[model samples]
Target: MLEARDTVEHEIWWEIKGGTSNVWYENWTKLGALNYVVPTDYPINEELVDVSDLIEGGAWNDQLLHQSFPADIAEHIKSEIYIDQLQGNWDRPWWMLTSTGRYTVNSAWNMLRHRDHEDSDFKQLCIKGVPFKIYFLLWRVLKGRIPTDDVLMKMKIPIASKCYCCSIPQQETIQHLFLTGQFATDVWQVFKNAVGIHMNLTQMKQVRYPCLKNAPFLWNELIDFLEGYKPILVSKIVYWNLPYDGWYKCNSDGASRGNPGPSSYGFCVRNCHGDLVYTECKELGINTSMVAKAMALKKGLMYCFENDLQPLIMETDSLIMKNVVEGIWECPWSIVAEVDIIKKLKARCNVLILHVYREGNSLAYFLTNLAFYFAGTSRFNSFVDLPSAGKRIINMDKQQIPNIRIRNAKNTSGMDIFT
Candidate 1:
């Protein structure tokens, strides 16, 4: 008998019997003989042993008796046998091995195993941050697959014992997020109002919990609630003028450098949210301050009407122009025709003309200066260079009454249309 170390440093004893001396010597030289034992094919029925049991049972069958086994020898043997069997090409789903590697039943594997088809839902889940386990849970929640506490615990989300938002001692699940949080309650209320649906808070919570899974309609309702609630919250903020949450306010102005000499006009329009809707300047040929005022009013009015807005409050730095517009003073004859037409248009809406200080109207003056710079090199008489703001106002007037014309220097040059 001969004894020596095998691959894992485990001792193997070889019994030499009935073999030629030369064969025994060759086996010994190759280290194939262990403890002077020569290799021999022992006839054993391998067919009777269940492969699964063989892998699982491990050292339960005492085939080798050279050494004593450890406390977990049986388990270690079973694990090794199972891995060997897996490598031996047993017919099973590829996912069983793949999932065993990652310890996760990824989506691709799950879809292969189950055949209920939903391409849209499947595509959505393929996005990052969606775990296979979580997606399965959501699908079950949508399909009424209420998981047991053990299954949920297996998911390994942090804070498994309580709701993350409210710290309630329960499974931190989707239902808790939607129904229990204070923010969620406010959101639900706004959502109900937006979709023209009325539901008590408690009723909404109850209905959503039980029906969310297994009901497509309920899933759609949840989607709609999420999508529509934000804009309604914004609208409420604007209507109430809440700080940092309301609509903006904008102010516009127009300026003319010299009455009837190298004139330019500027105007601005803004919303209650304080956003600049439009701002522009135009060079008008040899026009007075009154003409600039008329031009600015035209631009501002056009902007409001085109945007389908009303109840506008327009401010100008020209006190005389503001007074004339509001019927507090008479306008000059040179521009009264245009002013009268604008006043008539203004009366069609809730328009208020107020005189702002020149300091408050600086943006319009800046724009007017820009217009002068550009217009200095252009032809003065043609209306093609008129700002789009002015064009919008002119279009609005034409829409209101066909063929409305204001006589300028070409017809009744000195007549005041307001008279």
Candidate 2:
């Protein structure tokens, strides 16, 4: 009985007369009714079954209801037996503009109005710390304002509207460029590999609707990843500061020659006043970046446990490690073993994982890189002093000297991003 241009939110009901409305196709009851006809092997007299055929004297024909439909759906029909009580068995229309079973023109008009609110993801893109250029580009991308080939052609541009990134003749639409282009797909794969997120990059191109729909989430994660590594302006070298009151700070880093080649992990523990409590470095055989980072975190936690350092705050330049440790994301199978140990260590001690810029973590970075000079693992006890380079970096951090400047790149793929 419902007939409106936009009737998705509207509700329909029927007053029983001669049972003319088809029980299956017709919107004869509230949403809780059997809205769609469930096919079964039972025979029916016609394509449409009216309400009367399923009703008996003052009640539902239980045998017929059971024979004609599944149990759950039959029970739903049985619950609406009050429909048989219409005065004099006369049929009429019942409209439901409001969920409270009241119909009003004003309510109907309001329901038909377009929504006036931005998606939560859009609000995230507009957060204060985000660069204006990056924010604007993401906003445009979400609104389909980017200059894809189809949009360019519509604007009368002379260039052919074909995919250039993939070197394919396929028309370059927004979906094709971001979600299907071969080059774009390959870049995404590299990014996923480098970051160690537990998702298949190929699925971005394989699954059309879901991949494009979650683009905002993917962008948000990328921005977060970049935030951990964004370089700050190097003015004067500063010394590393200690953790806040009642917490010990541990800075950790991982170094690899060829990513999957020989690698090492290092961590330095400092008191609240930037005094070095201890430091340790381990030489790990061939392993991926993900494994190395995970090991570094695990090593730092172990150092704290061995030294009885409680309520520790661990800092690392690897966003992937921090995210995985904090349960923000998943780790790949290769690094799951390390992550599991890290989790157990974290649970044992009052541990907090923080992601910092590499510039701020120079001492840990140095120690990790320094492992390259030594053939075996190295450990410095409380009585020992840090080597010259490590001491120099620590001094710089304590001085609050800027070691690097963070800057946004002109464009990443088709969008501006911080580099």
TM-score leader: 2
Runs of candidate 1 exceeding 4 Å displacement: 1-252, 376-419
Report model 1's TM-score to 2 decimal places.
0.30
Count clashing residue pairs per candidate: 17, 17
C-alpha RMSD between model 1 and the true structure: 38.0
> Which candidate leads in lDDT?
2
lDDT of 1: 0.47
How far off is residue 187 in model 2, in Å? Answer: 31
**Mind giving the per-residue lDDT tens digits that candidate 1 earns over 334-366?**
444346556766767656666655544544555
Error of 2 at 93 (Å): 61
lDDT of 1 at 199: 68
What is the C-alpha local distance difference test score of each model?
Answer: 0.47, 0.69
